[model samples]
Target: MKNLLYILVLGLFIYSCSSTKNRDFNKKEITANANDTVRIANDSLEYEIIVIEPGFNLFINSIAKPRGYHSQSYLENKNIFLVQEYNSRVNQPFNYNPNLYIQAINYDNFVDYGYEVNYMLYNYFVFFSREYNQRFSVPTRI
Candidate 1:
């Protein structure tokens, strides 16, 4: 009876450790997903929106725990010229106000990452004007 009890206890300890390790691994995977776009498990339940612009794809993925759903928005482009900083937390803390986060993306870097820039003629002119207003202003040297 003593030997049998010792074997049972050892088996339970091994099983418990294995289960705990699996749980820890799962948590790590979920935490890592925050960095990029993913088709979340139960993704249909998560809220997500993606916006595309000339330079990048803006992606916002948030989960409303109480509602058991997530929300996301994608705002592309470097049009947003403002910056703000905040503490980081789990489960999409940015949902409190996604616009600020959307504005943080560096669209130039997105282009550097091989994203194509498709500029209509008018858009090209407008972008150029903003980028080179001083040059455009100089008197032409005939």
Candidate 2:
């Protein structure tokens, strides 16, 4: 029982030490408004972002692009998705790769957008995937 207690304590200590968020987050007052944007820092990068504290339902109503913004062919094509594969063959257990792919978008295309437009678009797609499992591809085959 004593040995088990020591192991449990040691495991807890290790887990606490490994938590990056606990070490980096500052114990400071977070000031922001629901109708406004706020600045947040992680590591050393400071990002001026909006906090939409609602789920995807609200996100779809507020931030998502209209259905006709992208064509049906562009939405369904699989060739444009970039597959991110970085698993070690020898050290890690082998797993089947998903039919994942990504498209390289030109930033110049969105030149008229406001500052952080690219950042917002990036986040939008991320949430779109989590909420709807929707994927996108480049117009041209890579």
Best lDDT among the predictions, by candidate number: 2
Which residue runs of candidate 2 sit more than 4 Å off their true CA positions?
A: 1-54, 78-125, 128-142
Model 2 pairs in collision? 81-101, 81-102, 82-101, 82-102
Best by TM-score: 2
lDDT of every model, 2 decimals: 0.31, 0.42
Writing each residue's lDDT as its tens digit, candidate 1 over 7-111 gives 999999998888865456766665555433322122443322233332211112222122212111111122211111211211244553443223332233232
Report the lDDT tens digits of candidate 2 across residue range 1-118: 9999999999999988888655533333232233333233343333333434335335545676665565433433321232121112112333422332222233333123332333
Our tally of clashes for model 1 stands at: 7
Predicted structure 1, TM vs. truth:
0.20
Please report how far candidate 2 places residue 53 from its true position, in Å: 12
Which regions of candidate 1 deviate over 4 angstroms? 15-82, 85-142
Q: Could you tell me which 10 consecutive residues in candidate 1 have the lowest summed lDDT?
A: 80-89
